[model samples]
Target: MSARLYVGLMSGTSMDGIDCALARCDERGTTLLATYEHPIPPATKQRIVEISRPGDNEIERMGALDRELGHLFAKATLSLLSKEQVPSTEICAIGSHGQTIRHHPPSSHQPSEQGFTLQIGDPNTIAQSTGITTVADFRRRDIAVGGEGAPLAPAFHAAAFAKAGHTRAIVNIGGIANVSLLHSEGQVLGFDTGPGNTLLDHWINRQLGQAYDKDGQWSAAGSIRPDLLARLLEHDYLSQSGPRSTGKEVFNLAWLDECLADLSSPATPQEVQSTLAEFSAESIARGIAQCEVPVSEVYVCGGGARNSDLMRRLAAKLGTATLETTASLGIEPEWVEAAAFAWLAWRSMAQLAGNIPAVTGAQEEVILGGIYPGARPRTQ
Candidate 1:
């Protein structure tokens, strides 16, 4: 079959914005066409965060936000199409990861109860609004088959980064950090490493009222509080086995407070921020070591890649010969995850299996996502 164009839309745990990327994909490989980032309005972001945790009217509020975000996602898709002058009809489908509010895979929770994961942003709405086929809800089947239903990016990473002679690790530092280990032998391994920018971003924003510690400059100005770092590292999650996954449920600000309360000196705001940065770097390095793979190089992506201090710390801790962004490999760092979704959508359309059984612990390979149709032909 000929290559098809697809749009992948992702709103990661950071809750910053929607990322849309246009990809031309076929069985051989996928190529990037154009990409765009659409920031979520403050009101929308506030509503989503508020509804993330349960309350009296949470379900109702969540339903409303789901549709709202779906529309926002559609707006992003349409805007990207307009900017690139690519007709919506020319795209095969849109693969939307949606905004994950809660992701408790069956393996992590009790089997008697529904092993549920919720991503708010209706694919149906995205289809209707954009007049393009949309494929989403990409996590359920893996859960049904006893998988962790996450770290799905590894399948996509393998497609893009795997080479016959080089082993590469793709680390995505979004709200959570996950690593996709690409082996020279064509095997892929991946899992959530631990807290990425989520905790650090939250603590810094709470203390300084800024969105994030820009390029980690604030953290670089301060020193890592060793005592606090030691205490935070004691969490068993750092030592947990792979094929594992985690979310805000485990590493939120509340969890941070428990560690902070045990500290001797009340760390200064900058000190705490610096410690958080150290914590992220420490946890990631530990996770990489646990992989038992001969990691020669590390390619960082997601928001944290911009944090110079975090990158420096990771480099020092891992002792890898070279460290750089996915851009170093010719793929834009910001668009990696977005491109993954587009590739996943293309896989779903082709009825091809997209999830790696080894990474997600699924019983077998499975085609991922539900489809939403577009109004016109998806090619020029």
Candidate 2:
């Protein structure tokens, strides 16, 4: 089959915005054609964060937010197509990762509960509104099959960013961080590391009302409270092996408060921010250190890559491995996650499998997502 165009939409754990990427894919490979981003309104963002944790009147609020996000996602898709002057009929499908609100993957803490994940922007709404096919709710099937149903992007990373004779690790630092280790011989390994920008963003937002630390300048100004950092790192999830995943459920503000309560002396906001930054960096580096295959280079993607303080801490912890943004590998850091979704969409349209069992610990590889057919086919 000849190459076909596809759009991928992702609203990650950050809850900051929707990222849409247009790309071409076929048997050869996928190519990112153009990209666009739509920021989430503050009200919408607040609603997302609020419901991400337990709260009352959740069903009513959640139902409303789900539809609201679906509309936002469709708007993002249409805006991208408009910017590129591409007709709706020209795109084969849209792979939407949606917004993750609750991710209770099976673990020691929640072993009794069945694993489940909820990513809300309704694909039906997206398809109906955009007049384009949409594939979403990509994680649940994997969960059903006893997989973490996450770190799915590693499969795409192995396909798109792997090197021939060296082991490379791709670290995606969104609200949560995950690492993909691509071996020289083509074996792919991946798992969620720990906190990425979720804590830092939450800390900064709660402390200063800023969306983020702005390259981690505020964090850079503060001293890393050894006590706080040590307490934060002691979380059991950080020590778990691969085939694992995590989210705000375990590392949100409530969790942070519990740790802070343990600190004998109160910490300044900057100090706490610094410690959170260090926590992210340390957790990431620890994950890398556990790689069975030594990694020669580390490429970081997602919002955390832009945090200078986090980057410096990672570099120091890494010691010898070359640390660079995914841009070094021809894909900009900011767009990697977005592009991965695009690739997943392409895989789905091709009736190909999108998840790597090795990474997510699924019993077998599975073609992910539920497809909502588009209203129009590409114009002949």
> Which structure among the candidates has the greatest lDDT?
2
lDDT over C-alpha atoms for residue 319 of model 2: 76
Off by over 4 Å in 1: 1-3, 110-114, 375-380
Give per-model CA RMSD: 2.1, 1.9
Q: Model 2, poorest ten-residue lDDT window?
A: 371-380
Model 1 residue 189 CA deviation (Å) reads 0.7
Query: Candidate 1's residue-wise lDDT over 1-380, tens digit each?
Result: 23389899999988878999998988889898889999899999999788877777887898899899988998999889888988776778899999998888765666587666888799888888888889999988777677888989999888888788787888999999999988778878899999999998898889889888889999999988889899988988777787889899889999889988998779888888889999999888877776566788889989999899999899998775478899987788888999999999999999999888899888999988778776544332
lDDT per residue for candidate 2 within 1-380, as digits (tens), equals 22388888888888778988888877777788899989899899889988887889999999999999999999998889888888887888899999999888765346677888899988888898888899998898888788988989898898889979989999999999999998889888999999999999989989899989999999999999999999998998887787899988888898999999999999999999999999999999998888787788999999999999999999999978999999998888888888888889888878898888889989888889999987644332
Model 1: lDDT equals 0.87
